[model samples]
Target: MLFIQHLIRLLAQKRNLTLLTLGVLAIILFFGLRPKTWPNINHAEWSPDTQGLMFHAPGFAYVDDLHTLHDRASDQSFSICLAVSSAKQLPGFRPILMFHNGSDESQLTIAQWETSIIVMNGNDYSYRLKLPRISSGDILLDGKPRYLGITTGDVGTQLFDNGTLIAEKKGLRLDIPTNEKKLRLILGNSPYGNHSWEGTLHYLAIYDKQLAPEEMAASCQLNDGIDRKNPLLLFTFLEGKGTEVQDQSGNDQPLLLPSRPMALKQTFLAPPWPNFTLSKTLLADIIINFLGFIPLGAALYARLRLSEAFSRWYPARATMIISFWISLSIEMAQGWLPNRSSTLLDLVLNTLGAILGVLVIKMSWNTMENMLSHANSATDLAK
Candidate 1:
């Protein structure tokens, strides 16, 4: 009993304020130590490979593996094929048709986009590329080439582009070319078939003449795991081969943004923060990343200081860390949701931005503190 009394007296000598501060510090440290690993968008190259090629425009070249910048390309075809099927077709001049949508912002659209060896005849043969205008990509096609009928629709076949209306319900017939012209399948708004399909790949044949039902069935195999029979699988092509993907060995296009990290897509209940951006959307951004000591930021303002536990509100860190975490997290979310990738450079930029904020705050901190002190002094004098 006497020893206990002495120990309590010694502890009491320490300031009550100090004890309170220590208690808060202990809590922060405990939770900060919790394993808080979030997702990263800027992951490495995909190992199994997604079976699609990635390309970019303005320079009309294939984007590099990073999918952030443009890479040098040997081919100049506007109707770039990102993915192709290895499902063997009777090795010959395969007549290929091309497609394009007006909303093609990537500028992969073609006016006389010629890529088919022969045109198919018939109105019922009306090709379709399944797309939801409610989504990002749309079907864009216009102008005419030789011996073919074309039409367009959004949800149902409402005849938006009347390449087929020029003829009656026989659905127009094509004069199959005796020689195979290099053909291309064009896609605009759709990035390798997600929200939009370049167009329907309805007619591929060994000869320009109609396929003998059996041959057509064999050629329709989707080598890249996509169903061409779906109305949105618009295999939009041209009358003649505009340009061919040079596989030297003639292999299918490999994955383009394979290295780009995937993301999840979730819509929050309260809507995202007004002042922050993740990809194209705005959300409440945790700006702790201006300094290198992130978990410290978490420790200081969020992890231990959190008002709610499961809520993802993390403390701001160094600009770079914040940017890295923010960019990666948002990007990875995109992958799980639908069409998205966590861009590496975005992580870099976001980090830099955070640093900028921290630097400014540090520079102005003393001045702001001094101003507040002066105001307090003035109020005291008035009292």
Candidate 2:
């Protein structure tokens, strides 16, 4: 009982209350901004080697990887860029990047058909464009390194080879519809056919917005500029010896290589908000926000009690105002984090929790006073 009385007296001091309040706030921020790991959809068993993702068209080998970035890139004007060194040029189709939107009925592919580059939108083969003269000449076909880039917008699609415009066709805009089904991104092969890329791929990048002509040229040169700043997904084959391709953009979408003739090699590489979703559980989120602010409310109440000139009703109003500002700050800061989300629901629940804490302290004031009075009486007896 004596220890309880002493602890209460210590918390009644303004400095002690302020320190405790700050400590609690620090703890809340640490957990709220920590890195999040998303659940993987599948795993591919493969041995580590050093060949850097080799695919065989005859054997129909490919890599199927799942990522969380489909919603961000889907239904947006985007750009795709990669560097490839072909071992043997095949007259048939060779897929470089293919994405399956859950059903075999829909897909987005960036491929090479004979000496031409192809961009297929949706499942319909009629919606695709075959850009002739894009991959011609000895630099691309004679087993040498060359950069390839493709940009798509509502206006049209543009294909670039080594910083130069090769061929472009209008009236074909690519977009993936928003649906409930999961999306899978494939590398080096298509899901339907045995059209696998037989080559060495150094890097691949996906952007949420169409790259300007100058930006596309800079990206093709492998130089650092705006191209490195705005990628939704980027993979640099610098892991050297693993089946996992590290996402250089830091979005946590690691690519899993299937049990094929795939490997990673060392390569010099260049580099590179919160949006709200209604999919989260309302009850669980409210409970968490409410619990997070309870300590702040208790601290505010204790501070208000130390003021001698305030009215009896001042503590409740002051606690509410202070809690509002604090919650607002947290939500605003969350906007800068890539994985964290800011919502009005969280703000309201936090304020409510603080108000509840103040009310609880107000109702128990007399009980605390009684305990302190008993402790004083015991101290007097000891004297």
Candidate 3:
């Protein structure tokens, strides 16, 4: 057809062919080198025969009534320390520790709300602490073990992560009763068992006295001598194959693990994509897409202009077609990337950008041709 003859004529020119080759290479490099936009899943699903204390939502472990830590509950000062890691990167209130008095009247809870840590003394009081310089991907998908310590004293309450002070509040005190009704300590779950934590708890301890800064730091090191100051209750989870977590602190208050079987292997669940909205992130993406396709559009316009076999309208149409195909290819490639999403919005924007670029080049060429014609006419009049 005439279109094929035009295309062949365009490629016959050395400059046009070189420009086309460069444009194709640029598109490939841009998409191929971009970073991933989603978290990688370590395991697709849990194995059938897996064994460990697994907690889905509403599943948790608590010390039985006979082994309640009510006697160890301190009214004035206390400290709680633990080593924990999450199994999935989910968005919800996940309680790591909760001490309940068999009623909703009062409780002590430490939980993760999104990326931040929250500690509540009771229903009336709560403190939220944001992690420093953390991204959503790091907060949600990171499955590495983290050391956490919470200490409340006459001065204030302090929260620590990996021996670093993350948050602090002054003039707040816990008023938990020592001999409260049905008082029990729950691990990896909420007092109501509604916001259960989906994670692994390696070690936990509760002390009647507020730990000193040095003691708190040493405790986070995951050392055998972490309890040198003597804790009122402790669960090391060293009894790897048992239903009960032995109390290494000698008070003999072992916690019963949840009955459900859980796999001990590392597991990760990818979070859902962000909702589509007109925000700064979307604006940046639009600008990037528009700028990225400009060169492709320009190259196509130049190549089409080199061939006289094509009509005046062919350049714009050919440019649009080439832009659309390239944009689609980039979007399709993003589908396999862990952190990327292949959206139709990007494709549309890219095509529009290419069209704009082609129009701009066409206008400039016409203006240059008119100026040259006027110059020749003026030269003839001067002669």
**lDDT (10s digit) by residue, model 2, range 154-245:** 77778888888776767666764334445656676555333456666766788777888888877654444444865777776666656577
Model 3, 1-383: lDDT tens digits are 34444554565586865677586648655663364312222111221333234445445577765244555545568888887767764455567777766543366777665556667655432222222211122332476667788888797878788887777777666544455446667766554333446766667777777888778888755677545578777776655565676777887777776544221111122122233335576688778877777767766776677667668889789879988987787777555443355667777777888888798878866765666667668889999
Ranked by lDDT, the better of candidates 1 and 2 is 2
Order of quality (TM-score): 3, 2, 1
TM-score of each: 0.28, 0.48, 0.49
Pairs clashing within candidate 2: 53-263, 228-272
Top candidate when judged by TM-score against the true structure: 3
Report the Cα lDDT for residue 219, model 3.
75
lDDT score of model 1? Answer: 0.28
Q: TM-score of model 1 relative to the true fold? A: 0.28
lDDT of 1 at 193: 21
- Give residue 34's error in model 1 in angstroms: 28
Pairs of residues at least 3 apart in sequence or in different chains that clash in candidate 3: 37-339, 38-338, 38-339
After TM-score superposition, what is the CA distance of residue 241 in candidate 1 from its true location, in Å? 30
Give the per-residue lDDT digits (tens) of candidate 1, residues 137-217. Answer: 112223121222222212121111112222222322222111122222322112222122122222221211222223333
Question: Weakest 10 consecutive residues, lDDT, candidate 3?
Answer: 262-271
lDDT of each: 0.28, 0.63, 0.62
